[model samples]
Target: MTRIVRRLRAVAALPLLVGACSASAVFADEAATTTSTTSTSAADDVAPSTLERDVHLFVIQKDGSVEEHDDSTLRANTTSGVDDIAQRYVWFNKDIEHVDLLKAETIDRDGVAHPVGSEAIRDVQEPRSAGAPTFEDGVLRTVIFPGVEPGARVHLVFRKTRTKPLQAGAFAYLVEPTRGPVELQQLIFDLPDDLPLYADARGYTALPPVTANGRTRYTFEYRHGTYAPIEAGAVGYATWGDRLMVSTVPDFATFAAQYRSAAADPTANDPTVTSLAQSLTAGLTEPADKARVLYDWMRFNIRYVALFLGETAAVPHKVVDILRNRYGDCKDHVALYGALLAAVGIRSEAALLNLGPFYTLPAVPGYGASAINHVIVWIPELHLFADTTAGGIAFGTLPTGVMDRPVLLDGDGTLARTPAVQPRGRTTRLQIDVDASGTGTFAYRVEDSGAPAELERNVFRRATHRQAQQIAADRLRQTGLHGTAHVSTSDVAATRGPFATTLQGTLEHFTWPDGTTALPALTSFAGGLATQVQAWLAEPERTQPWVCIGGDFDETAEIALPDTLRVTDLPTDTAVRDGFFDYASHYVFDPATHVLQITRRLTAQFGHQVCTPDQFAQMRGTLQRIERDALSQVVVKAGRM
Candidate 1:
């Protein structure tokens, strides 16, 4: 009987489920594809808080003019909603509470005016981190599209307590019928002096978005003449949105200190929030302990499923709710992790990432704002980036897709890059000899652990049964023997986290094609059949280095030679080493019997050295030379001994 979860399968032409321990998976339907998206505002659902704040903001537009949206002019309370217009004098409330809002409005194509209302959705909160997400239970969100979209040239006017740039930790995407007639003219983001940004190379059109009047926007026409292909891993990031947007200020520590003091007020009894503030500088005694707790917590809880559909995918469920439910997307997983680290006195931040093979940050700068949707986190203090959303990997290591990309939302308000480490690798192989009747067999198995295995697994994990057979067939060719053969593989259950496959088969040339055959390794059909070498050397300090892994094999063959055959002389056993590669070969023969025994071991030591194609060619030449001396020829006498 086989046990496999039905839900654990690929979706949306992607490897949605990254096998958590329990084996639950995220599924995507290839049929339900989305083609376009609208950039909506964050102020549509939130009600203005009654708490008084001493914050004031000024919008420096292309044309120097000041617009005021203070509290007295509350937006017109009307049945027909009219909150965002170009010239309409309306009260606007930006969705964020960290900064006080003075005024907010939107412009249409004809420059029409309308009053803006508080339609922000505040309750849609997402906790950021690896373990349990610390969610602020109830919050509202935006009901309007405050920031300008690609179509109408839009500008935002607001103020904050600090003069330095304030990043929104946000991201946006523009999708339209590129396959149709419409051309994608441009995708742009307005940058504030306080916030810094970088774009993914693969996601954004290379021409670069147009910037004018202190704002940055990506502009490209989706015409066949100017078409830039967008692949699966495509996503963008910036400081103004959920992307790993980040920024820094000179007095941030002093500013942070003040916030901590204010948060400690008598009315603030929230345990999680208060604990986070208190632990910011004194949580864990050591770094490893902090890492383990966070790693284990995410693995044990916050189940991973890669649903991530439409705008709903962008909107995060409360971290607390995910904690209670014991489930979350990558964002939820990392959101909680970031919060927990903060709670435990570690410095951490959220990262917007692209975790796949087909996508990369668009080469032209600024399009990174469109190239990422998946989120993870980085522990700056520990200098380690961990992946808990998937399994069959060691902690502190990340897969290739997340490597060397920038992290949006870093504290610096600039495009901060995260350094990803490779996964732990392993490989194993075995060799043996079989008796005449094929009943008894002796074998030796070898295993390797490191980078090579990781690279091999990435491909093997994605192959089907047929592909698995080719791998098996390829091994047989290495023996310097050949014949027509059929290959087959064992049935595998999907519950396994790795893409693993096993195959077995035989060469069809069961007998000599002629009456007589020359045998290497023996004088009378059993001469030079053995090789010689010594035990391999190991580096005491350095680790194994391999880009592709999992090169292991076990080989065995038995023989009852030509009607009447007898063992004659067996070569003397020998071993040799040079502090690097090692080899040993042994052979034995019994005169009273027509039997012979042979065994060989070879191990090569390799580290961070320059290996060129020419070097590999030379190595192959050397192996052939050794084979010539070791298994050259075996004579066959017409009579039995």
Candidate 2:
């Protein structure tokens, strides 16, 4: 993760206008004087105009409260760019945190210090909200420095106090290194003698701790030239990068225990909840059917609203409140769904999941709240995971983010991994009837399951009939067809089994004109596959490992040509295989019926979601072959009418 330091301007009265207007001019004069005195060198030419020295200190009090102090010094390399620097901004949450400005000043090249005026400080609300209720939680404190220029340094120090811990006895802190080059960066943690603290560092080495003054201080330092700017398109850096994590609670078990204690009683009996569950499962005797009914009710009826203020970050709202309000966040959905399942004699547990790219849990033993960002319900008996917050997801399906990842179950503090779902195959079929005038009528059908099915349901649920028609037309256009398409599907709201879609359209210019003979250049049923391959080939190189969402694609197209046209040339068959991916295409022409049939299949086993550089090269080669095969066309000649 990258750290951003925001700057703002000051609008307060000042003692002299020179401190404001003449600062830039005076700094420019100083820069000329310094350049004349200093000898020119390669180091001087490449030197950065600004350098940051940052120190962050976290002090854990005896009662689990934390006091955080962040101090930084920004030095300018040249005197001319001083006024280009603006006021520093510090962010804090007003709901559970407070900020205090300790020091703000500017130091000139001559070692003269000027303290910032008190009237130069202003507090503003943060524009973005992470959890909900809009942008009401955060406050930004701005400190305006008057004498800023090249060779001038601005220093800012602020303290933030978390009055109450997210969980009563648990505490966790994360330190993400600043981006860009830095002169010095330090992270310090002060802990009481009796409090047990577990610290873990990733992507960097951790130094030893020093104890003094009846307190233990843990320090981690990064000297100049040690930081590297993150590369673009680097995947999974946020969850797997170099950073420090400290937690008071010891392990995942402890974290699960704490969560279970805070969650609603799964077995608690309520007439309203029981009645609703019974009504949903009135005639269903099978456990799976009953579970599906309850799951669907929660998913469709309840809206998702995240409220992670203080303890609510770990605990969930009451089931009664969630039922009455008809809306709740992930945890609330888990709680209510679990209760409903229990009422209907189906056993379910609350499972904590991390929705990021990190599938493997950290080996470090600690009860860190940052480990998991989502919660869902798990049916142990049925061996299924249900995420009610993901509205369109079917009963037994789990999103790729949570699949095959370790989940912390609430009840017995058990750690379990979700079952990995294999790629669900998608099959598309097209039948075309062409006339001698080069116009054709086509019928197309698509069938899909699992994640692909969920995606189709979501797309159709939000799209109007005209939008669907346009989408179909767009897909056809990729196949070199210019015409209108009408698409329809079975009720997307009906949740069960595989999803199916049907489309009918007219194709203009079904054959190309070349003197007397006509060239048949219709788009293949595997048009999307060819496009994807071309897009991948367009990239020079991939910085991150290629991530392929595992899936299978099978497309077949059958075209009936008019008697006036005879097949002259048919596309050649192709088969290519790479690591975890396979592609094959076949073409067959029947002389009796004058029909051309093409079949294409692509299987991608991207369950791991990553491919090494060597593997990617092989995959790209295979895709190129498939693209060539897809672009191959059948030619036709004029025959006796």
Candidate 3:
């Protein structure tokens, strides 16, 4: 249950009630139809078994309670091959839901069905680390069928009953489409006619509801003869593709009101909060500066520990508890930060943000909490959204995940979008000096601003100096160079401007062995830019639109050749521009000084992270050009310049 909640917290755009059911569990149960056969080779032994049928049914009661049932049938068909369908497990919160296993059995090729013994079922508590809260409410039930082998089929059926609604009189459920090959896949919802239900079918069509026994049933079904896997580099299929959302809640405004009610008391007038806020901003004259002081203090001091149990999922911890513990989840951070801001005479609202691959909200009309998993403070006066849970984010900037996404303002009950924060252009400057022996010494200064700068700060915060040096060296080696490196950074904890890191390293085999004519190895400049570009372009024919979270990158490298080497040729300069992205590279060779200078910049001005197939083609071309430019070499000859 905790695992399901965690996943829901990450990618959920509707509400946890809608997204908690496990689709993989159903898929695992459906792999029993393939007939047993002898494997032709070892390669065939490890191939994934196919699922025959995956089905789920949700019976929604008039009182808003839901009973979810899943049944899957599958087969193991090859001799001496892995039976991927035999394993089965179900996670449920004992306090909020009841799980009942109706059937678990194995059917042999000869049509003999053997029921699994009760002894095969086991219950266990998931392990937890120290300092992490023990969610004692959840339990995992495992069922192992006997005599599961090639030529045998495995079938499993289970039902879960939610004792109460996540919110009073509000019911929601989501069914995600199966990923692998399947003969039949379906999702059926049985609802009482009296209940108000809003349904959205994304990436698939929803059939009209059928009414019987004073109830209306909504059905969604799909049949894939062969596996249709999502494209490589795609955000999860659930994040962008087929799924069904059903909710009893009416609209976004009502949903916003529910959230506002949970976070009703801001604790602005508390004596302790007032004292701390005063102390934190005593000498700051400007309102923005004072806000920054408060924001930074909360960002560094509060530890983020997510506790999304039954009721606590929606209700934030009390301000007093958050302050005393000095650690809380995103909502808790918002509580403390909001209180401090109010104490300092700055008005702010708690804004709900859905952080992850999801950017646009579903066009479905309903008030569901599944889509929002994080809370941040929105300063109306400054027109700024501050995410204190993002430890080192700049005061005025929002994290990449939250920026440009729809946010629900708490008190106003209004759904609004956060402004996009474009990259200020993180820059890396490199200087390399090579000796006659082909060994080189290098120095690098990296200036990172905006979200990139925040990421750099987190890296420095978690790693020691030696560890940072090793990380830098490993990054340098990715460019096809071998070396040892050292790293130093500006005071990242206190500074708000562009964070900088200075790195020094020694490179081996800096020059290629071509007898008299030598070539300088191309540097893999600026944090895997070439690798990222190649990966983005790996799949040429893309069905789904490409999503590029906004960012900008720049790299400049100056290589000083040894006096014995003279420049002969250089890689061509190139430029590419499009609505989604821009790339430019320039090179200069000085014959007298034996130096080669290269500058490259890549910027993604994608206001909206989504790109159409045509836009993706343009972006792919730009990235390819950038990769070619980054890998270009400097040709040189053995002679005094």
Candidate 4:
């Protein structure tokens, strides 16, 4: 797939400070310079396959269009590596970008070259872009290499020409190291002598610029001769390793201003938009309340459609068209919602954002199409960031995915960050009563806020009745119980309050009156402690930074025994307070009533979304302690006759 098409399709799959800071100043402070690692010994430590040679050439014209060429060679050392590099997919936009396959060949271990004929190359539409409105310039060129096996090398060369700039007269590009080891990689930029370039090379060695024949050339080299093991739960590699970011635009302010000019009020002087806005917010007086109403209206009414056809990549459709069709992508949602807010006398700026996995923005200023892929509205009057594209998310709650990331506000040309609200955690209360027949009836309720709340709320809302029942049955089974359960949940549509769900059930063989019986794992429903403990234990030793968003989980359970039974033992109480994590479990047995009460609370409130290995280690120890405590069960026996 083409780089841009792959990037755009990646939207279906899965920020920087600006202001006053010149491009040079930003790069000087945040960019890290590194020397190339030419030795292959370090790469051997983790190499399953190696990138023998990777090169990219970009020629930027004075009119802001780009001509790009790429050449890459991959050598597979193992069978799995062959599978990983066997087939190549080149993606491009049929409308705005022109692509040509320059070469496709495979070299066998015996040094025999097999060139791929035209029959080996297949051109097709991107699967995600097959539908009607979603169909755009997405085209995939699949090249199947011949004689690809372990110790064989596959090579490909392709060129793409962008007839128009992503923006009107600006170009931006970013490249990062692959997950596997790389022997040599080069990124070269050919720019018109008069077009100043802002570039940041982090972990890549930047060579001196050469100017000749009315053009200036910039090159960045990267080499990692040693295998770099990828750790699970680690932040994006762009944050920790090699990256080359370049933009013809001088600063974020310039990029934002240019975008604002191109994306100018699509709703201006549109009476239908104004009328609808008036109808929606007629009764709401407060700006926050009005914003909420309009945001919800868009979420419920407008269907999200990914349309990358033509200039739509950098521009949004007219507000009227979006309203008439009742469907739009993130940018469309922002356009219509912002226009509606405007009609209601509430001002909102369209905030450009990188809704991708990474949290921080590169130091170099970049156009929205390359660096920032999503848009939301910023209500400066209320100092709130609203993402209307999130259908199930509450009005005030930003999905954890976009929290704390940098934003480039249109019109204002300033950079800001979304708030990283501390998670409200999850709480559950469970009560069980055992009769003489060894049957137990229980009532369970769980409530949560923040990201957990958003997730749980959507899960039940989207589930069919049968699916929900299966979920309940699975939860019960996970806790080592067989039962008939009926579940009732609060209305997840209510955006102002915590989300809650209650499960009531009857289970057989809950306990034995005459013999010792082990306690069940009660918190096995949504956000259960036992489940969390197991997950933490699964990854005890983390090599990378952990994504430890702050949160707490609290559960309380009361078990009432029959008059014929007596409790002989209960788990001991334990309290653990560690860095970024606090946990406590308490057991109280009322002998006079034959009731056992248990309370467990775990709080993990890290300062940031990314936590250090040391912090995770401490949290891991705390979870281990909680797991051991959870293993303790109540010992019960028949009452003395």
TM-score against native, each model: 0.40, 0.77, 0.84, 0.88
Write candidate 1's Cα lDDT for 175-216 as tens digits. Answer: 222121111222223444333333222122344444566654
lDDT for residue 95 in candidate 3, whole number 0-100: 64
Candidate 2 lDDT over residue span 390-440, tens digit each: 877788887766776678887787788887555576778889988878788
In model 4, which regions exceed 4 Å deviation?
Answer: 4-46, 128-135, 226-228, 266-268, 306-312, 367-370, 434-439, 480-484, 508-516, 521-526, 533-538, 541-543, 562-566, 617-623, 630-632, 636-641
Q: For model 3, what is the error of residue 46's alpha carbon versus the real structure, in angstroms, after optimal superposition?
A: 11
Q: Which has the better lDDT: candidate 1, or candidate 4? A: 4
For candidate 1, report its TM-score. 0.40
The C-alpha stretches of model 1 lying farther than 4 A from their native spots are 1-171, 174-219, 222-286, 307-316, 342-344, 358-360, 363-370, 404-409, 413-429, 438-641
Task: Please write out the lDDT profile of model 4 over residues 234-302, one tens digit for every residue.
Answer: 555455445566777777687778767766764654999889889988887998888888888888788
Point out the higher-scoring one by TM-score: 2 or 4.
4
lDDT of 1: 0.34
Error of 2 at 314 (Å): 1.0
Instruction: Return model 3's CA RMSD, one decimal.
Output: 6.5
User: Clashing residue pairs, candidate 4?
Assistant: 1-89, 1-90, 1-91, 2-90, 2-91, 15-361, 42-226, 43-225, 43-226, 43-227
**lDDT, residue 262, candidate 2:** 73
